[model samples]
Target: NKQIIDATIDYTVAYKPNIAFYETQGSKGWDSLQKTIEYIPKECFTIADAKRGDIGNTSAMYARAFFENMSFDSITVAPYMGRDSVKPFLQFEGKWVILLAYTSNSGSNDFQKLKIDNTPLYEQVIATSSQWAGDDKLMYVVGATHPEEMANIRSLVPNNFLLVPGVGAQGGSLKEVSAAALTKDVGLLVNSSRGIIYASNDIDFAKEASQKAKEIQQEMMGYLDLLC
Candidate 1:
């Protein structure tokens, strides 16, 4: 995060801390995350990739922790728990609820691709979710692996930004995703977590990481040009 903050002059936008990466280390991990986030520039987006999906009031408090307390700009939410469980997060303005639509993980097919009421589960997720919130407040997690589906999802809700992951190490094609997902405002945020951040184990790791970021940014620049 400090590297991205200090190292790059580009409009890098956001930094996400996947909670599992921190939680696996216990309390110290959580503390480190807090410290890391604190150092992030106010201009850059900060996201808690907690993927928190709980029920009732329990869901509300989790929303407060990330949105109210941590002051994160956006959060990833799982809709399987139902819209009620996810709606509490939508109450914040200028904050985004990145609802999981179709993910890149190999096991996602077990449920996401399954048919329900004659519609694919992911399509149903997009259809049902489009009703709960407008595009400005709600974004969807459409994995880069399913770039072809992005256009279909957009046809459902054209104005929303799609927080796309799996572009780098996961072999998701950025070119294809951008082709299907780009909005007039350059809507897709193609995340390259492990591929960029963990690029090297050598002492000058941050420099190597920046190189990876530069590569992605150039590709994004091309997409931005497409918007123009």
Candidate 2:
């Protein structure tokens, strides 16, 4: 894990640790996660993929745990409970709230695509939650699996950042997503989990991971230049 962090310093812009994986190991896992966050380069953003949401008071404690205790730069949030569930995370200055809009999971179609007032719920989530904070403090989770919908999402919230997953092992095309979603801010944080970190299980794992991350970073550069 340390090797991967060291290897990715130059090739990636952020590191996200899915909290469930850590919580399973109890205190050891929590310790490892904290150390990992510390090891990450200051220039790169750190995200806690906790997907937490609840009533106002409970949500406030979660905000404190992640934003104040662990000190993550941003966190992934489930916006099902409306403004109260999400507002606590947005209260922290310089920290960000990445609301789940359209997830990449197979079951996402269950409700995220349901139409409300003639618009998809995911679209409404983006449109409404974006009003909570400016682009700097709020982002949306738009999975790469929905490349077809990328353009429309961009149209809805053009200025906000997007924490996109489903690339690499998930069969999401970075090239296609970039074409549909790239904004003036280059507003996409494309994530490749198993595809990069597990590129090889051998002793050369870190080397292979670095190579995979560099490949993605280099590809993103061309698209970024297009905006210039």
Candidate 3:
């Protein structure tokens, strides 16, 4: 992990460590997570990727655990429980709540794509959640696999950043996603997890990972240039 960080931090602006990977290992894993979080450069944004959201009290504890305990800049949250489940996370100043709206996995269609009064549930999640906080404190997860939905989502929350996964290994097109979602601010954080990190398993893994990340960044820059 340290080697990857050293090699790619130059091209990476954020690092999201999915908590499940660490917690499944118990205390030793937690220690490693803490060290990784601390090791990340202050200039880079860090996301817990915990996807936590529950009742008010439980939510508050989750918020404290990530925001205070871990010192992550933000955490992904499941907003299906409604405002109370998400509000606690918003209370912490300087922290961000990245609400799950449209996910890349097939199961997302079962709920997020369902219509609530003719509006897709994912759209409702964005429109309704926008009321909870401004773009500064809130962002949305819109999967790259669903690039067609990006324009609709941007219309709902034009100013909010979108954390897009499913690019690389998930067969999502970075070009399509950037075209649909990029605002003048370039308000998108496209994630490429296994594709880059697991690019190689041998001695040259870090170098290979760096090359993969560089290719993505260069493509992203081309899109950014178009916005100018």
Candidate 4:
């Protein structure tokens, strides 16, 4: 992990460590997670991909654990429990709540795409959640796999950033996602986890990971140029 960070920090803007991966290892894993978060450059965003959301008090503790304890810039949260479950996370200034809307996995279709009064549930999540906080304090997880829905999502929350995962290994196209969701502020945090991290497993892994990240960065540069 240290090697990867040293190699890719120049090219990467944010690092998201899915908490479940660390939790499985217990105390040692948590220690590593803390070190990794501290090691990342302060200018770069850190996302605790814990996907936590519960009742009010529980949610407050989760928020404190990530925002105060770990000092992460943001944390992904499951918003299915409604406003109270999400509101606690927002109370901390300079911290963000990344609400899960449309996930990249296939199972997302089972519930996120279901319609309520003819509006897709994911869309409803975006529309309603947008009212809860300004774009500065809120973001939505709209999978790169759903480019078409992404366009609609942008319309619903035109100013909010979208943490888009699934490009690369999951067969999502960077161009399609950027075209559909890029805002004037370039409000898209495109995540390529396995594609970059596991680019190689041998001695040259860090070098290989750096190259993979650079390729994605270059493509993103092109999109930003087009946006101009």
Candidate 5:
């Protein structure tokens, strides 16, 4: 874990620690996560990828736990409970709430793509949740695996950033996602957690990870030009 952090901190613009991974290990995992967050450079944005959403009051505490106590710049939220479940997170100034809209996993199709009033459930989630916060404070999770729908997703929330996973290890094409989703703000945060961090297992793991990050950064530069 330390090797992964040391290898990619320089090139990574942000780091997301999915809380479940730590929860499984009990106190030791929590300790490691705290150290990992501390070890990360202050300049990079941090996200607690805890897909949390509950009743209004409960949601508020979850927001505080990550944004205030843990000091994550943003967090991923499940919008299953509607506006109240998400509103508490928006209450914090300068912190972002990345709502899960369309995920990369296969099971995402089971619900997200279902149509309600002739529109996909995920579309409804995006359209409705966007009303709670502006682009600066709200973003959506759209998997890179669904690149074909990116243009449609972008059209719905033209100004908000999209936190895209599934790149690299998940076989998502950065080019396809960028071509379909880039906005004037270059509004996308494509993540490649396992792919880059676990690039190798030998003594050269860090070296390999660094090279992988460099490769992604170089690829990103080309797409970033679209923003110019």
Candidate 6:
């Protein structure tokens, strides 16, 4: 958030600023984050990557804080607290909830891949959460790093948009992720954080970032054409 003022000018439908990155630095960090997000174009979606995990009225307040006060277009939420906890965020029109289904980190396997009854936990998340709202109101975070399982998720919620992470620095296979997770509506927002945004450490960082973003976007355009 400190460096990427022009980052949103690149090819992306949205820019997600995970709260953890800013909060770790305390109140001053929070102020910087708000200012940084305020710089993003209104046409581009801005997500508060809070992954907030709480219940009921408390969750509602969190929703209010991000969507009402912070004024974000979307938020990342953990659905473990069930429908009641997750529904508050969906109450606002033009706002989306990108629920965490599968994540990029190795520790994700600790719970996300677990089997309950017969289906994998991630599969269950897709199924249950799809029932909460229609595709336009909700999306999911299915990491690009998990290509083998990507196909399964696509089958589960075919229409909703997916915010994918871990494509570049994490060694995720973009080809496979695109093949498995794409929808005809250009629903895959593949995120390359360190790969593009931090592409250069020198003075030419933003230029390099834009170049990398364009390269990825061109690939998206190609996929879009093929899918059409």
Candidate number with the higher TM-score (3 or 5): 3
57-138 per-residue lDDT for model 2 (tens digits): 9999999999999889999999999999999998999999999999988898999999988999999999889888899899
- Model 5 residue-pair collision total: 0
Relative to the unseen true structure, what is the Cα RMSD of model 3? 0.7
lDDT of each: 0.84, 0.92, 0.93, 0.93, 0.91, 0.86
| Best of the two (2, 3) by TM-score | 3
Per-residue lDDT tens digits of candidate 4, residues 155-206?
Answer: 8888888999999999999999998999677469999999999999899999
Give all candidate RMSDs, comma-separated: 1.5, 1.0, 0.7, 0.7, 1.2, 1.6
Q: What is the lDDT of candidate 4?
A: 0.93
Error of 5 at 77 (Å): 0.2
Per-residue CA lDDT of model 3 for 1-228, tens digit only, reads 799899899889999999999999999999999999999999999999999999999999999999999999999999989999999999999999999999998788998899978989998888889999999999999999998999989888888999999999999999999999997864799999998999999999999999999999999989998888
Tens-digit lDDT track of model 1 for 1-228? 566556543647778889888899998987888888888888888778989888868888989988887778999999998988998898888898999999989888999999988889999999998899987888888888887777888788778888888989999998998888787854777788888878887877778788888988998889879788
Stretches of candidate 4 exceeding 4 Å from the true structure: none
Better of 2 and 6 by lDDT: 2
TM-score (C-alpha, index-matched) for candidate 4 = 0.98
Superposed Cα deviation of residue 26, candidate 6 (Å): 2.1
Higher lDDT: candidate 1 or 2? 2
Could you tell me every candidate's TM-score relative to the true structure? 0.94, 0.97, 0.99, 0.98, 0.96, 0.94
Report the C-alpha lDDT of model 6 over 88-120, residue by residue, as the tens digit: 898999889999999998889999999999778
Q: Candidate 3: deviation at residue 87, Å?
A: 0.7
Residue pairs whose backbone atoms clash in candidate 6: none
- The regions of model 3 sitting more than 4 angstroms off are none
Candidate 2: misplaced stretches above 4 Å? none
